[model samples]
Target: MMHDIPDSGDQPHLPTTYASVAVIGAGSWGTAVAATFALAGVDTRLWGRDKDVCDGINRDGMNARYLPDVPLPKGLRAFDDMAAALSGVDAVAIVVPSRSIRAVARQVAQHAPAGADIAVLAKGIETETGLLMTQVAEEELEGHVVGCISGPTFASETALGYPTAATVAFPFSYADRLKPEASPAARMAISLSTETFRAYVSDDVVGVEIGGAVKNVIAIACGMMTGAGFAENTRAALITRGVDEMKALAEALGGRRETVTGLSGMGDLTLTCSSTTSRNMSLGLQLGQRIPRAECFDGRPVVVEGEMNARSVTDLARRLGVAMPICEAVRAILHDEADLGQTFAALWARPIEAEPNAMDLSFAHPASDKAIQKLAERIA
Candidate 1:
């Protein structure tokens, strides 16, 4: 169980931590999260679908396949059976692919303790349902308060115990939305944060989720530009314009655009777009160099979320009457098989418009004010 936090802290920091937590997924991110929690003195158990991965973790003190070099603590447990892994825990975290979130969430709903709050570490819009991972969890996870934690964290660097930061957000209405007994979002943040991994609490759940989903698509566009030998100026333009697109979509979806400028948005965008280590960026690199589509999809170590989210994001944008030209361009190239040159030309040919006005992107909401005030009081 997670202990009560002190009455005050800085960086929205938590003084206490969870006694036990279960992380779902054995991939790089999942492995790193579980190991970090264990290192922080939590009784952490990790669940992966593959028995081999579980056996390897139990025997080697590492997830040799995903995080071969990061040493896991001896106390961290790994299980192939979901129920067995989550049999006892104060909270649950889901880190599988975006596409798998629904199925995994359903499974979690079936087994997680009634008091456990759910956190979504995966980043994507459900292609089939157009629901954010948190929303999907809310839909399937009755009586559970669902929140999101995300930033520019790269798994390898994080698992090796490097300093990392992420934004953990649950709506201000988190308690009212799910159940009366739901723990506050600040507590959820506390349960996952540690000395090295500091988590900042916020009430912008929509803003956080939108940032994660959009940054991956933006990274692919940046990668394509880089692979085609574009200079820094060109890349900067793409990232800047991508932020505009992101801000536009976030506002349309009832999220605060200011949140898009924070860790989840700009921070994540900068890392993914510039790093060749990113799966989405690497895939874009191959495409830019004229690699065949069939070949680009082959042998990737992990799900290149940007490649798949391209279509879903564009589709969502259209349904909501928002303009996300860059994401749409990426969708054309990857999914519609549009000619690269024509797509680029079409993307650059759109009519120039004034940059988004500040008033258009931000609004005051009585409910949001209450949420923000609640968060402020917790960390005061």
Candidate 2:
């Protein structure tokens, strides 16, 4: 059970802390999130599929496999039993690979505490369904508040208590604390935000999801440029055009235009595209250097969400009637095995057109908006 928030004389509805939380993965990001919660004095449980990982974390107070050299809080416990981890947990932060989100959601739906708020840190579109991570969660965790988070922090930096910021967007029902019964998601956000890590709230869940998902593919393209001996101008051009592509898709999918320019969008895009530490970027570097795909990531511990989402994102863009050239190029290179030189040439050879101002929100998608509203109503 979560502690009831005491009514502050000035702000009566804010929760200062959460009682318990479960981070549903043992990956570096998951371990870091669980550590944050535990250090915040919340009872936290980390659930991993591997028994050995759980045993190690419990025994050593560190997830040596994922977050080497980073000390974990004593209050943070690890469990292989999903049910045990969810016991008395108020919120669940899922940090599994994008490909595994649906399977994990199925397990969570069966075992999660009733009314627990759920958020996913995984960034990818479902290959078969083209659904976002939050959408998949909503499918399985019916009637539960489902949210998605995205932003610029690397797991390694975050685990060291370095400054980090993120954006978390939920369905409209959970966007504001209109009613105490409707505040579970808001409470989860408050508990997750700390001095070192900050989480800003939003109602544009679709925008946040799209931003997080597409940025990885863009990062791959940037990495390819870097590995191909391209100058900074080439990388800058890709990043700029990538933002336009993201904006177009996000707006087409009923997300606000401004959302794509915020923390989840531009912030995440910049970080992933520029950082060599990014798994997707590093994978792309290998690809650009002509390394076999299998060999590039053969023994890597992390799953490059960009590699998984490249095709799915391009497919989604086509389905939504949105143009995402950079993302498409990445898919062609990665999935279709197109030659990098040819792809780059083709991209540059495309006809030049006047750029549309992404700031303008006049383009309407009533059907998309209505569908999202209906979903929110049904779940609410």
Candidate 3:
């Protein structure tokens, strides 16, 4: 019963003459996305702010620092010159870390070709404005089509061409008018869709963004449970409770609750929580082991988005008068405001309530037949 914008099979192929794509940020996820586009026959250019990293990718076609042992496609190009990379590209994918999203967007806005549709791959709430990625793009890259791609994708696995699924979110009105002739940039959009990877479209931009941002924090909590030697029952409880926190936050931020239940929400939370490959979850494991955050994060250039998102999400929940005990506890642990034992005790000591209470009922009721019928009508 999930509402999705129909995929227009008419997405234009990359121009044989000179279709260009520039992917900002050459981190693991960025590199993976760039590789995917290149394999799909786009004239792909990957931009890394680090000259050495760019040189490595250009010379060896491998990003050893971030994604070691994975050879990039021959068609993938690397560039350190932001201006050269951005010049004349049909579309650009902004894949920088969450905390640096604004600064990177400004740089792209200044350099990327006019009228380019920016597909943002960065996922995190801006700590300063609490704006979702698309909002940040709208503020910085005015007049450009903004889209978001998010899900429970692991960069390493994605780079290796593992089958993966993700959601692409934009306005439904824009999706309705999507034709091969819409923009020269449309060529880049075609390469974005591929066989091994699938992208479902949605108009619920905020919902998708929230799902991508909030799930990482929940992943951290699940990791804590695992590191603490908790069993499957505990993990299941954490996942369920985590979804509640995510739905509450998503709803308060004007996102559809159903979006959180889809791939971006429940799907992402499950994947991140279950995998040690997740940076946020690994960070939590390290914290649970009593390792200092600085030591655990030492020499790690990649962003553990949940660490930054925890603060912003907690702050937003507080401002909106929403209950997010898990997020609040995470914030305390991250900021050293409380010890893990104290936080764990606080969580355990929380007031007992019915199995389904308050916001919990919102999720439970949706699976009922009556609710499904109502949702079907809404989507139809």
Candidate 4:
């Protein structure tokens, strides 16, 4: 019969270092992230602008608008009051769209504590600015230890407590100010990990951002092809080559190629591109069927980020001369009014050059590997 999450005295001792965390945005991903944090024994506050969604979570332990069927953790509470949701939290996770990250980060700066570490859970490039979500957060929340959390997490599955993993990357080092081995990102990774949700920490912030952003674009392309009646061979090729495109853009922006092979890159890319459940992929499917863009999202409440990200990502790639034919083609279809059939034809007819890059296709780094193993040991 209780509505809001019980007081601290009614809860068990928290497992993660962070005793409290606020997740802004009541959409699927945000709700999922907040739910898992609560299940992990953290005091999780979910902030939503929509009062109805907030009331649903507070009363029913579900976001009827975003995640209707799944029951959220008892330790999770939803708040319409942003300040109240943010008050006294040890960390914050901004789960808004990349386009809104700047504004939301500013609000967080105003409300969250001075020392709370922040992580961006959204995946996309700003259409107008071409800034990664993490960059936008860093610019808006200066002096905050900002990081990124991304991988192949589906909102429903992850929220339901299925096994999920993500790469948490923060470029700044805070060991001098925090615990001996605790970087802001390392702390974030630990705070986010649960029995079913594993966290991998990394410093390749740019790489992780690129992988997260571009994969959506690639997923759109795959959806287009699939909608056009293409089969497994083509889809598989797109995924494999899509990895190259993602890797190239990341390296052009000072991200490591190896990061492209990790959870945030290959892992997320595979799931989004292959699954019709993904909004980006599904949108492309509609477009390939010659449906109008306006009609695609007519009743959909969640934003399909790839639709906008295509423009900024294409522009950024061109500015840096990164060869991203697939992403560029996607932009053309979505923005330039290019016919889907012709675009697919052009992609197929393009000059076949020798495959570039050795395509190491492996993810390894001493620090990340060691830390992951240690986490497994602790959990086991």
Give the residue spans of candidate 4 off by over 4 A: 1-16, 172-180, 297-302, 358-380
lDDT, candidate 2, 1-380, per-residue tens: 22233445755556546688899999899999898788777899999999999999999988988899998888889999999999987788899988999999999988888888898889989999999899988999997789987889799898889999888777754234445324544566677777788877777888998999999999999888777766589788988899888888898999987898999999999999888899888987777776778788665665788988899999999998887889988999888978776676566655545657633434334354444454333322
Weakest ten-residue segment in model 3 by summed lDDT: 179-188
Runs off by more than 4 Å, candidate 3: 1-18, 174-189, 297-302, 354-380
Q: Where does candidate 1 have its weakest 10-residue lDDT segment?
A: 1-10
Which digits, one per residue and each the tens of the lDDT, describe model 1 over residues 1-380? 12233445422543346578899999999999898788777899999999999999999898889888788889989999999989978889899999888889999999999978788998989888888889999988989879998998999988877888888887666343343123456666666566778777767888889999999999888888677666698689899998888888888999888989998888899889888889888888777767776677575455789987898889899999997889998998888878665566556545545555544453344355444454333322
- RMSD per candidate (Å) reads 10.7, 9.8, 8.6, 11.8
lDDT of 3 by residue, 207-274 (tens): 88888988888888777757665668867987898888888788888888889999888889999988
Ranking by lDDT: 4, 2, 1, 3
lDDT of each: 0.81, 0.82, 0.78, 0.83
Clashing pairs in 3: none
TM-score of 1: 0.87
Task: Please name the candidate that would achieve the greatest lDDT relative to the true structure.
Answer: 4
Q: Against the true structure, what is each candidate's TM-score?
A: 0.87, 0.88, 0.85, 0.87
Model 2 spans > 4 angstroms off: 1-10, 174-182, 297-302, 357-380
Model 4 C-alpha lDDT per residue in residues 1-380, reported as the tens digit of each score: 10222234774532236889999999999999998888878889999999988988888887888888999888899999999999999999999988789899989888988889899988888877778888888888888878899999999999888999999887754442233225666667767778999987778889999999999998998888777777788789889988999999999999999999999999999999888889999998877666777788675665788888899888999989888989988999889988676666566555545666564343334355444454333322
